[model samples]
Each structure stands twice: as structure tokens, then as C-alpha cells.
Target: MKKIFFLYLLTLFSLNSYTQNLIWFIENDKFGYAHKTTGRTVITPQFTFAGYFSEGTAVAAVGNHLLSSKYGFINEKGKWLIIPQFNAAGNFSEAKARVQQNGKWGYVNKKGIFIIQPQFALCYDFKEGLAQASVKNNLWGLIDSTGKFIVQPEFYSITDVFAGITCIQKNITDKWEILDIKKKTSIKTNFTRMHAFADSLAPARDTSNKWGFVNTHGNWVIQPIFTNASSFSEGLAAVEKEYGSWGFINKNGEWVIPAQFDRPGYFFKGLALLEKGSDIVYVDKEGSLVFSFKR
Candidate 1:
């Protein structure tokens, strides 16, 4: 089946070491290239700036003029896979790429053919089977890979589809609500700020500015309590309850680890990166330090 477009860069549930295969920079009046992970030089720095590779291809700005930029796709071996033609472009997703020309946005196939017309004011890369597009009113809605409107441009804001539900904000006064595309109705909500329910739970904020967890049915499983909170990852979430410190919490609102770090990022690959003073540390969900790394 053809994949749908995405509203934004969707985070995968499973964590892995995502790497940029190549890097590009301008050096000595030319663009230079190197293997980002290995630090090995591949192409001489000659282009003005280089974008990361996606689907084994990348785009580069060749001249000094920012508006003169054209896009080209390159292979892993630094060969030109598709010559630059697009006035502006984004990485490929779901076998299609978002491109800009004549100050409008559309999609192009791997072969660089325009598959969708440039009509929407903004567009996100495809994911699952839909992409988010913005209408003139600046409201966002979902479209399929063929640019067909599947969800009309009515939502003031939206989150990527998680599990099978997407969080959408209908109006500035309205709180974030869940939308079951299958049901075509807003899922009930009591909290103002909430992440899309995944794994049967989501993070929500009370009017008092405290944070907690809730199930898909809009029931609070973890009462509204923390000062700050993040979306769940690996059954854990980074939260802050006191000034200048952060910690992790489980679905039941249990403090799996004491609030201690200065700042904590969401967990990935069995570890979460944290800060203390000027130092950075990796920690497990239990709050034990895994290792320290240079920031």
C-alpha cells in the first residue's frame, strides 16, 4: 500500500542510534563533505551548504545566492543520483518528497516529477498514509499521498498520528483533543495540554499548570501534579516538580527516580541524556547514571 504523508517528523516508538551518513560544509571558498559518523572526508568542501542524506540522496546549495539555490540528490558514494532542479526541497518520505517552486509547495516522486500541485501554504513529509497541509487560514488538516484531502483544513493545530489517534486543537480557546480518524469525532478531554494517547496513556496538564498522565478515555490515571512533563517514551517520561531539577515518572505516577537533574531529555535507546550544572550524563529510567558525555 502507498504510504500517507505526515504532519511533521514523527518519532518512532522504538529508539535507535539515528545517524547522518554524510555532512556538508563550505570551506576554502568551496563546498566540502565528510562522513559525519566517521569524520572521513568524502567530497571537497565546495558547495555553499549541504543537507543531510535521506533515502540515499541529499540536496546542496551550490552558489552564494540563497535564492539561487537548487536541489540535487546524491548517493552514498557521493555520486549524483538526481541532478538539482527544485528551487527548494525537503527530505524524501513515503517514496515522495516535498518541494517548493514559484513560492508554492507540492510533492515530487523519487524521479523528480511533480506528483502533487503547489496549492497549500505548507506541507509536512508523508508518514503512515497522510501528510498535513495548511490552508490560507493557516489551519492544518491531513492529505493523502496523492494530495487528496482526507481530513479537511480545519484544525488550528495537530500532532502526528500516534498509535491510531491524532491530537488536534480546534480553536485557540479549546484545549487539545484527540481525534479518531476512524470515528471522525473529537475524543473527550479535560486537560488543556495533552499528548496523543499511546500505550493506553497520555501526558496532560491541568489548569493549575501541573502535569500528570491520563488514559485514552480521558480519565486521569496519574493525577495532575508535576510542574513540567513530557510525552511518554519506553514506559517512562521526564518530569519536573521543583525548580531547576528534573526526573522520570511511570504510568502510575510513581517517581521511578528522584528529581535531581538540572534538565532531562526524553529517553531513547534505554537511556536518557541529562544535565547537571555544566555536565551531561546518561541515565536509566531508575535514575542511576549510565555514563557522562561531553555536551
Candidate 2:
């Protein structure tokens, strides 16, 4: 039994070693990908613009950024899984990507074939089997993978589905409302401003423009007091004080890091980036500086 467990750990290590690292690296004037840890070139510098790997593919464009150009996809090993052809394209999500053809928008499969024909004026990547799209520039709605409208195109703007619901803005009033696609139910809220739910909480603004955290039920979990608030990351959220200073807080509406810094980045990989004057500092969950770099 001990020998079998040792072999299991060895297999896990071998699998981790085979995991591909994709990091954007610039050379000459083009961008390509390199191993995130080893700094080895995975794809030679070729694309004028390159995006990070998503769904086993990455988006790349070769022509003018300000003018018309073709976009396509590349695999982790630098192979063209889909050659450049579309006028514009976004990274693949759920095996589908929104691409522009002629002057209309449509969804394309991983093989570069249009699964949904170009018809919408604008289209976004699919999320949770639905894509936010618009036939007219002013009205937006959600569409299924087959291009069927799950939600009719009526709102002025709609966010991508999150937590099985989407936040939509009315055409005239610009008021934010939550719509549940599964139940086809809409919940109205009193927030003057709102953002999509992240980590089961969304940043919302009251009538006085003060920001706070709200739960999936649209109830304020943290009172509207901070001048600004961001989505929770690594169990803490960054917030701005009335004096324009920034700090991090725990989910229970308690201050974990004092509001003192001028700028703070979201907690990622067990550390958060912060700026003190011209220096970059990385802080851990306990608010202790783990690393620092001065400019």
C-alpha cells in the first residue's frame, strides 16, 4: 500500500510538469507567448497583438490595431488551430467565440466555423451557455448557443450572466435590475449604481453615491459607507475611504488592513499588489509586506 501511494504522488508530479505555461512576451515589435516560470519561448514573437490562453486557445491579430485586421486562434504550442480570417475576434469561451464578419457579429466554433451566423450588431462571448447580443445598437439581450433569444432584446445594456442572473440597465431610466434566466424572473433593486456579483457579493452604490457590498439576494451585506469598493478577492475586498485612501477588508464588514495606501490591487495567488509613493509592495493576507520593489 505504501508503494502504491508513493507511485500516486510521483504520477501527480509528472502531470504537473506537463502543464503548459503561457505568458505574453514582447520581441522586436510583436508579442508572443513564453513559459510563465521558465521564461522559455513557447511561440515566437509574431502577432501584433496577443491575448492570454483561454479554453486551450489564444487570440492573435497581425495587422493595424487602429484599422481593419484579421484575428484568429493559436494553441499553447504555437500552432494555428484556426487561421486568421475574421475582421475582429474575441478569445474562445465555452468552445465559442464571437467574431465579426463583413459588418455583423456571430459566434464561431473552435474550428473557425460560424455556428451562429452573423446577424447581430454586436455580440459578446458565451457564458453559462448564453451570450449577450444586440440586433440594434441600442437594445441588448441574451442568446443561446443556437442563436435563439433566451431574453428578448429590449434593454439598453446587459451584463454577462453571473450566478445564474444578469444585471440589466433600462433603456431610459438607466436603472439596474437583476434578471434570473433560469426562472425568467426579474428582481428590482434601489441601488443607484451596481456591478455584477463576484464571490457571491456585488459592489453597489446608494442614492448618496456611497458604495457597499451586497449579497446574491440584493441585500446589503456591508453598509453603504465607503467612497468606493471592489469585488472580494482572496477573502478580502479593496475599498476607498472618504479621504481617497485605500485598504482591504474582510467579508464580515471589518477592516483587516487599515485604509492608508494610495493604490491597491486585488489579492491574487496569496498576495496583493500595493503602491506606496513610487514603490511596489506585495502584501499577504495579514497585511505584512512580503516583497517590495522601489522605482
Candidate 3:
């Protein structure tokens, strides 16, 4: 169930927020950080792979994603705080980062001490004081920073915890159910896909394979209609119409940026990445192409 590993590994490096004015990016197959506002290089691209800094530290690897063995923690200054030894590493969250040792996963503190022993079949970075872990590759559950099970291992898989609410699915069941971290409510649902919550709403796919947004209470704020959709960021969500054209939509379901781009990304810090034919362009919330990357 190192699904958490797969989920993170498959993502292409993008401009992800690190600190208030810093961001992470990849150039020439190497990962580094840069100033978000001025677009100036702060940390040069050196690591084979890099993740956004959390609590001032990031996870970096030195080789291919699958066969790589050199993984460690790096500080904002691009210095190794923890030497590369683990098989895999998760970005620091809540001052702890999940790491793999001898094929089992555990969490280490800022000092690289194993606060939790390497025992879980899979482990994820803590979010909202809890993390998803699996035991023996079967019992999925929620564990606190102390490595105690807050939610017993019984579900098939656990989704990201957001706003004290996380949706889970039962063993072998296709339907999803909600788990209220605060209320300890029983999970239940019919969503074909339950995306991570963003901007006070989460994207859910109906049985008909259409996408829409639902509030924390599970009420549909926007009807399921888009051919393809993404979670919101900065009050805007990227969606596609019938002909594969992409645009940005406000929470009210109104098109803020009319469908025009061939493909689009979420707005991060007032700008989104758009695809114009084979090239990449950065566009503002107003849908104007501000910067185009030369190939």
C-alpha cells in the first residue's frame, strides 16, 4: 500500500509554494527553489528530484524515481540536514517527515530520529495532526504524531484530511464515506471519485462520470456537468468544455476565463500554467498570457 509513494512520485514538478515568497521548481531534470515574486533563482537545480519545503525542509533524491536509494532531507540553503540513506522520503510536515527503511515506512523528527519505528506498510506526511498509515498492507487507518491509531485500521483507503473531515472507503467497496475527524462520524457515499478538498469545496464524480463541487456538508455547490475538472485554487478552478478547451471558473460556476486554452492548470499565486500548442505559457487570473517559456 505504498500508494502514498506512488501518488507523490507520479506528479510532475511544478511551481509549488514553499514559504511565503518562495516556490519549488525543476529545471533541466534537476529540482530547486526560486523566489515566487521576482522569479529569481534562490536555490540552484541540483537534486535529481525535490519536493516543496515544509517546516523549512524538503525531501530530495539522487537518482531515478523507482530504483533510487539515495533520499534525504535538505534545508532552504540546499544543504543536506539528513544524509541520504532511506529508500524513500516524504516532505517534512508538522516537523516530521515519513521515511522508508528496509522497505518499511516510519516518521523521523527534524533531527532525523525515528520517532515512530519503521513498521507500517505505507505512511504519509501528517496533515492536520494526523497521517494515513497501513499495517501489513491491509488495515488502513489514521495515526497521530505519537504513532497511536486515532482511527482504527479498517478502511480500504483513506483520502487526504481536510478541514477536519476525510472521506474513506470500506474494504472492496466502490462507494466513499466521510470520516469526521472532530465528530468521529461513520463513513458513507456514492461518489465514483472523491478529490481532495480545496477552497472550502471538494470535487466529486457522479455515477455518470461528470464532475462537480460539493461543500463540507456534502451539498453540491456546483452541478456535475464539466467533461473534466480540477479542484479550486485562489477562488478559481480549471475546467474543460465539450471540445477539450480549458478555462477557469469561479466558485459561482461562472467562467472567469472563457474556454480557450488547449489545457490549463490551477491558479497558484495569481498565475496558472496554460498549454498553447506544444509550448508552455504562464497566464494571469485574467487569462492573459504574461510569460511564455521558450522550448
Candidate 2 lDDT tens digits, 1-295: 4334323322221111112355554565567666644556778988866665677887787886524657888888878889988887777878898888898999888888889999999987787888889998579899999999999999887876777888888765666787888898888888777765667787888888999998877888999999988767768888899958889888898999998776656765565656667554556778887655442
TM-score of each: 0.67, 0.75, 0.81
Writing each residue's lDDT as its tens digit, candidate 3 over 1-295 gives 2333323442432323355655555566566777766778898988776776667888888876546648898888889999888888888878888899998999998888999999899977787899889987487888998999898888887766788888787765577776788798854667777766778888787889888888877778999998778778899998888848889899999999999877657776776766666455667889886555422
Question: Given candidate 2, what's the lDDT at residue 70?
Answer: 79
What stretches of model 2 exceed 4 Å from their correct place? 1-20, 25-29, 64-66, 230-250, 253-295
TM-score result, candidate 3: 0.81
| Top-lDDT candidate index | 3
Ranking by TM-score: 3, 2, 1
Candidate with more favorable, higher lDDT: 2 or 3: 3
Mind giving the per-residue lDDT tens digits that candidate 1 earns over 110-222?
Answer: 78788998887888777678888996788988898889988888988776566567778888678888787878877667567776455567778888878888776677888
Candidates in order have lDDT scores of: 0.67, 0.74, 0.76
